[model samples]
Target: MLHALAEQNTPEVRKQARRYAEQRIPLLRGACVPVSKQTPRDLVDDAITDIFLGDGDPWDPNQCDLLTHLRGAILKRTWLEIRHRKLVRYSPFDLAEGDVETVLARERPHASRGDISPIVFASMIELVATELRKIETRDGPAQVILECWQVGFVERREVMLLTGLDDETYKLARERILLRKKYLPPRLVAIVEDLLDRSA
Candidate 1:
């Protein structure tokens, strides 16, 4: 089966790869416990796609069998899904954890500006820009977020679209901002807190 998956590159081999993945659906489901219900299914699909696309090196004949390899793939992908969930708090552009309606109302274009005095708002923006520059190494999401902000993208949805980031990259960037937000000056943090308090 490993040989077929690695060498043949034929429909029969692809079919066999999917068959093996199907056999491990239960294992995948068990591994994805506490994750979204669709995660296991997505992992299986990813594994199958990997097999069909020949994305990874062929399974070493001496290292493992088809079942073992498929299970490992399932487990690996499941872990990534779990980690992503841990990092990501809400859907793109949604407010962090809090009163959803209130946050949304505050985040509205006009309302957000009205919520803060001009001087404080300018200070907050300057603080964020200065602090972001002081960070020697920024993660992908952080960089993307900074770029979006520099470009005057206040809306998450617009930032996402303009940045052309996939779901994982976007989530990662957002997570970095939340985690790194603490490093910002106290006043900046307070302003950010008032805006959106989702932590990494």
Candidate 2:
């Protein structure tokens, strides 16, 4: 089928490819974290456009099936979108900014140019540690929230599959987590808010 898609430069071929792409939509839904700037449908549209364009077909009879290839493509696009947003959100990483590199170079004068500066790395670690500490509460809702945000268990059904919780239990845990956030420290709440925003 993919061979036909690759060979035929016709409208029918393109339509068929779009149809095939649509079939894999369910696999992408909740499989990837949501992009703040775009809907999942938009990302799916981008994936289909990639297929219709010259990006690799990714189908291999000997290696894997069509849905698997499409799933990988969807995931790839998700990460690409997130990284692009991250660059925009953290513009200091832009090499075009004058004196930024000089400051970093001065701070890490002994480090090789390829290595990430210790200052930047340490800040990232601090952010992660702070957030993790807040979420490591005695109640188990933190685990649920972290699993959903960090481990790609974005859907309640998916979390249920891994934790073996019933639908009602999962729903209650999610609600409890949200309610608990109200009482958390402002800084911790801000971090959790950002995570929620990014994963939306």
Candidate 1 residue lDDT tens string, 75-178: 55654654464355333443356542334335434433214323343344455567676544636667767778666574556778888887778777776666
**Which tens-of-lDDT digit does each residue in 81-140 have in candidate 2?**
545644454334423343433443454444332233334333434544454556446657
TM-score of 1: 0.30
User: What's the TM-score of every candidate structure?
Assistant: 0.30, 0.34
**Stretches of candidate 2 exceeding 4 Å from the true structure:** 1-44, 47-76, 80-129, 178-200
* Alpha-carbon deviation at 85 in model 1, angstroms: 40
Off by over 4 Å in 1: 1-122, 135-138, 187-200
- The number of clashing residue pairs in each candidate reads 1, 0
Q: What is the C-alpha RMSD of each candidate to the true structure, in Å?
A: 16.1, 12.6
- The stretch of ten residues in a row with the least summed lDDT in candidate 1 is 26-35
Model 1 lDDT on a 0 to 1 scale: 0.52
Per lDDT, the best of the predicted structures is 1
Best by TM-score: 2
Each model's lDDT comes to 0.52, 0.48
